[model samples]
Target: MNVRQIDPKQRGFLIVNSHPAGSAETVRRMWEQIPCRTDGSGPVVLLLGHSAGYGLATLLTGLRRHGIRGVGVAFEGAETERRTATAGWYRTAAADSLAQGAGHDFVFVNTDAFSKAGKHEVLALVEERFGKVDHLIYSLAAPRRTDPETGTVYHSVIKPLGEPYEAPALDFSGDVPKVGRVYLEPADDEERHATEQVMGGADWRLWVEALAGRGLLADGFTTVALTYIGSDLTAPIYRQGTIGGAKENLEQTAADLAAVLGDGGRAYTAVAGAAVTQASSAIPSIALYTAFLRTVLGDGFRTTVEQAGELWDQLTGAVPLVLDEQGRIRLDGWELDGQVQDRVRELWADPEAGLERARAGADWFMEQIRELYGWGVDGVDYGRPVETTVPWPTPGVSHA
Candidate 1:
């Protein structure tokens, strides 16, 4: 794994192809030079909610080197909601011109995955083009979800369980960033129920059933949904709060759906570690914890891409997939190590010490947020006119 950060236009957020050693272009060259098999032994992975999420990065870093087909779904929001017009524009560029620059078999579905029409579009593409999807990875996080049956929409909230919870938060969203103890109260009954209904496995089941009905799933297929369970500090807001109930629902849904997919198919909900994500930064306590963790732990921070690569290795390892007592894939095991936890707890117990140590941590975390949108990458010359679009390479010019 490359620990040193490369240019964003080269390998980071911007991800423009520079045709360097070990780059996607180099990988393609090796494939052709070695006279390798055109068809690889890898499975076809379909990712939903990829553009601004982790699933895409996870799978891409793991599978892109192999000559496997890839499919993704993401929407560009009008004003930076989930996918923005700019997001669609640039992501489409990366998918075509950079990441899949070698003319690899890749497809990008730019639409709303939550809607029936969008789901149908996904199904139609798979049936017509790919035929069978080997793995289905769902990593979507939307603010609101409309009940498929009742048609009543429910929005998710990120508040504590009982009394108001106070935690030190770094607000870089303001003109000047500052850390302060912000207070947030618990959610009402409606908010709690709605959060569970939406973020839970209800949607996962719906998506799987849809694909299964159409025979789009490959035999011996495995599906996985991402979840999170942090340290005890954020329990009231994350694990024990409304989102926690929703997560419990998600785990249960995964179990039920896995059983339903009994034809050699498996489904699992894996707990992911806290890192800099568009969604995590919105959550009150998680952001603070991540900053503090980074402060104490050095560049021990692993982005979605690194986490996914680690996960892929475990999934395709020599032995069977291991699970915790609760039958859950404990991907966050490293993050919750006893030693790391003890140190973080020690700092949490003393805010004076915490702030003193984590003074630069929150600021560093904020810098990571900039990388998400291609701002903080090196070697990206803004002085030059930006090339915002490109048709995918093919018979036109193979980076291969």
Candidate 2:
């Protein structure tokens, strides 16, 4: 199936498009590229938030590269009439594609990771089926989270920390730039806790504890979480921002999880460079930074699939470790490059420089942003009508 035709008028982030067949085909191709494991024993990988963008691409790469058989979970439902298409459909198509091509079992869980019951159900499924998972990847990024116990929902906000800062945001519909402040209502204490609860480590701990309790962790099993370390310019809006706070907590959780893994197991945090992920697009300042990063990184930039491949290699010991001066894994070294950050800071200082020294860079950056939504993508035929319906995997189907 060809990529779905996107309407030119949609303004906000377009994470989910109606492209079940295209997504399935993408997954099929990814499965073909995975190298077979030499040990003759397949790995079981559990991927959370495996529906769109980086998470989706990571799942595809893991299944393809490591010869892993596993389950994927996403909170979105199938055929929801919401602004974005249901993630359930994409997960179903992805699982079907993997099952058909790799002969591996692919299960999709349709529950929000924020809920206690949802977390429990996922653990129970893993216990009942795989018994233990070899690797766990947490790639969840949500704006708000609801406490199942308290029935209180927490909404996230993006606002200026010190003073009102005006940044250029793309008016996707008008295809023009309008200066706007990243302002939203301040989050209350409950909201902050809820956001932390939803986006933070409670669920991650639950997954690890449940699996550990069941004796599922194989010797040398690894858990990895994706994170970012944007420059100081974007730090308040990002790294130290509310979402940044959540990410910091996530990093701490990774360290804690490492201790829980004992000697044989490991937990790591990969500071991935900026890309057009579903979650990143929602942040106010990220788009501009992403555009700049794309320009500087150029065509050499890795897709989420490529990043996932690197992540899997690191986790499985296929790739040698490369540690930064700080001793953390350096997947996002390109972003932290002195020259790249200097140039970005200059652009941030003078917006007109975005128009000056980097015309090709600006154009390339904008193109990458457009391509995030499957629009202006190279080599795909947009004029062709494609089938929307693809087979969905049953909830409890097991490969083992």
lDDT of 2 by residue, 39-61 (tens): 32368888888876667777767
Evaluated at residue 329, the lDDT of candidate 1 is 75
lDDT (C-alpha) at residue 380 in model 1: 53
The residue ranges of model 2 lying beyond 4 angstroms of the native Cα positions read: 1-9, 12-17, 21-41, 80-84, 160-165, 171-173, 177-191, 323-327, 356-385, 395-400
Clash totals for all candidate models: 3, 2
Candidate 2 clashing pairs, residues 3+ apart or interchain? 34-64, 34-65
User: Lowest lDDT 10-mer window, candidate 1?
Assistant: 18-27
> Candidate 1 on 271-293: residue-level lDDT in tens?
77877766777787676687778
